[model samples]
Target: MYRYDEFDATLVAERVAQFRGQVNRRLSGELTEDQFKPLRLMNGVYLQLHAYMLRVAIPYGTLTSQKMRKLAHIARKYDKGYGHLTTRQNIQFNWPALVDVPDILDELAEVEMHAIQTSGNCIRNTTSDQYAGATAEEVEDPRPYAEMIRQWSTFHPEFSYLPRKFKIAVTAADRDRAAVKFHDIGLRIHKNDAGEVGFEVYVGGGLGRTPFVGPTIREFLPKEYLLSYLEAILRVYNQQGRRDNKFKARIKILVNSEGVDGFANLVETEWNQIKNSGVDLPREEIDRIHAYFASPKFENLSGESKTHKAKIAEDKEFARWARTNLAEHKTSGYSIVNISVKPIGGIPGDISDIQMEAVADIAERFSFDEMCVTHEQNLVLPHVKKDDLFAVWSALKAVDLATANIGLVSDIIACPGLDYCSLANTRSIPIAQRIAERFSDFQKQEDLGELKIKISGCINACGHHHAGHIGILGVDKKGEEFYQITLGGSGAEDAAIGEIAGRGFSSDQVVDAVEKLVDYYKNNRQDKERFLDTYRRLGAQPFKEALYDAA
Candidate 1:
């Protein structure tokens, strides 16, 4: 929703020109592949197993219908007819030709989008809750702060090349929809006892080979010092973080090695010197950014819509979708509708060009021309009027985007594993597809209830396997692909890293193992307990026994 000013536009244009020159040099043989590797990565271009992949940033997961149309155009013209939405709320074009990357970047720049800082060891796209401004539970919208961090960190000379990649997430809601605790720096916006707005800062949270739920470093930091505090954290990490071993280069490793108190003291010492510096955000600037995220106009209406109720009564399909895919909105008579990209047997986050265009049209016609890319690999019309729900559902159904499986077993989150990623050990998409097909029945999925299954092709954990209720990790064992399972992981406010079950399962046995665990839970759960609640209550022992020890 934030438009680029002349400075922002000029900066992006210059970067595009630079990248175009770089691409031309590589193509012309002036630069070898070795020489162009860093350059390409800096521009969010990666040479995958099969082709070049381009990742475009969608800041804080917010986009206009116009921007969505531009993405659809790029998917149609430059890459394959589809784009993959990543766990970070960015989109990936997996098959862009090396020569056409500049053109793709040019198209993206026209819509104030780019792939800058999407892949390199600098601060990646700053993400927030998809329903930041529209939800009633949040103390305030977190997007403004996320945007401010984005503007400050883009091409910051000090942090351009850290020991490892950095990520920051912000959340203002009571629920942690953005997985803030799993980020390098997580900021939770809250009001103090005196009613003044501030942040609760968490440091050193990340997931990879070594996963950690970041510890709270500061209980209350005033909003004005956010930039200064972040700078302090980065400075500490840059100076102390490991550079010799890439495996242990993350800030989480440093924090763990030095203990949370030691790290916090270092950050405090650094912050003391720069707390009042010019980097501290001025009140006017904060207000200006906040204004850009102000709520859209809504017609006065009752909390419940008669037409919506009537439509649900009339259409069973619409009623099911409403129950599974809709969230309560702050504005009365308006609901947040989640469009699940994970249809049964389909790739978890892949959206075709036609589907993208259809969604754009639907957002423009019914959701006031704005949409959000969620961390759960779904699109959201955050302000759809309740009265217009049925029409929107019909339109989405026409494009095959009306899957009513938001948090069900079929709505999986997975990475472009061995199918696309060069670093992957085994295929992830097929496993996800098979699992979805296994639980294809909507009634069966509803019966399963709020089950999150996340899979990663490797230990990179790009699919956020560590945070799922059922986490599956693919591994290479003597040139064969196998999967390891973990249970009871969560990414909400009470974040916890999942504990692994006993032995690995071959690809053929993995899906059946998952099914067995689900069935065990269904048979053993009390009342309406979700899979995660049951797992936590009974611990992983029972599930592990059911998965491996059962005859």
Candidate 2:
């Protein structure tokens, strides 16, 4: 909902022109592929397994109706007829020709959108809670602060190219929907004992070949000092982080090598120098940025609309969809609706061009023309009225978007694995599809309760397998694909990395292995306990015994 100012418009236009020239040079053979690699990466272009992939940044995952339509247009006009929503709250078109990328940028810039800073070692898109403004229990909206960081980090001279890419996430809700603990920097906005608003800062969390749940360096940083503190942290990492080996170049590696206390001391030393050097935003500027994220006007209505209840009673199918898809809203008589992109046995996070256009229309009509993409690979209608639930469900069903499997086993988060990614070890999409089909029964999924299954093609952790209740990572053995499973990881308020169960399974054996894990959980869980709760209460021993001992 934030409109591009004159400065923003000019910056994007200029970047596109510059990238166009760079693309032409590579195409003309004036610059070799080695020479063009870094230049193209800076503009959000990547050389994937099949072709070039253009990752367009959707800052904070927020999109207007017009912007959403343009995305559909790009998918239809350019490469394939679909786009992949990634774990970082951005979208990737996996098969764009190198020549057409600049034209794609030209199209995106028309809608005030671009792919700049979406790649490279610079601070990537700053993600936040998808339901920031619409949720009922948020301490405050986190988008304004996320926007502040985005503006500060964009093309920042000091930290543009770190030892490795850096990521930051923000959350203001009671629950950690943004996966704050698994980011390079996670900011949770909260109130102090004296009613002052500030942030709880977690640093050095990341997932890849090596994974760690970041440590909390500062328990409470005053909101005004946010930028200065971030600057200090980046300064420490930029100066001391490892660059000799790409594997150990992340801030997480640096944080662990220095020890948590040692890293905190270093950051403190840096903070003392520039905490008052005008690095932070002024109060008036903060207010101006926040005004763009103000809540829309709502008509006061009582909770639990009678019309919604009546429709639920009249339509059993509608009631079933509502049970899983609708969430509580801060405004009375409204709901936060999640449209799961993971249709039964379909590819996870892949939405077709027509589906995209349909979602745009639904948001335009029922949800204040505002929608957001979730890190779980779903589209959210953040401000839908309770009385309009039936109509929204109908529209979604018409486009095959009503899946009723939000948080169920079939609602998977999978990267475009061997099918698309050059770095993949196995085909993750097929494994996800098999699992979804095995658990395709709606009643079975409902009985299984809140289960999150995340599958990654490799150790890059693009699918966030490290944080799943049941995690699967693909590996290579004897020229064959295999999968490794982990249990009891979470990305919520109580964040923790998952523990590996045991040995790996073949591509054919992986789905059965996942089912066995679910079966163990379902058979042994206490009353109303989730899979994570059951796994935590009991240890990995029980699940491991159920899996390998049976084999």
Best candidate per lDDT, number? 1
Give stretches of model 2 more than 4 Å off. Answer: none
In model 1, the runs with Cα more than 4 Å from the true position are none
Error of 2 at 458 (Å): 0.8
lDDT of 1 by residue, 1-551 (tens): 67898999999999999999999999999999999998888899999999999999999999888899999999999887999998889999999999999998988999999999998889999999999889999999899999999999999999999999999999998799999999999999999899998999999999999999999999999988899999999999999999999999999999999999999999999999988878878889888888888888899988888999999999898999999999999998899999999999899999999999999999899998999999998999999999899999999999899999999999999999999999999899999999999999998888888999999999999988999999999999999999999998998898999999878999999999999999999999999999999998898888989998753
Superposition error at 428 for model 1 (Å)? 0.5
Which residue pairs show collisions in model 1?
A: none
Tens-digit per-residue lDDT, 328-390, candidate 2: 999998999999999998999999999999999999999999999998989899999998999
lDDT of 1: 0.93
Q: Which ten residues in a row have the lowest lDDT in candidate 2?
A: 542-551
Which residue pairs clash within candidate 2? none
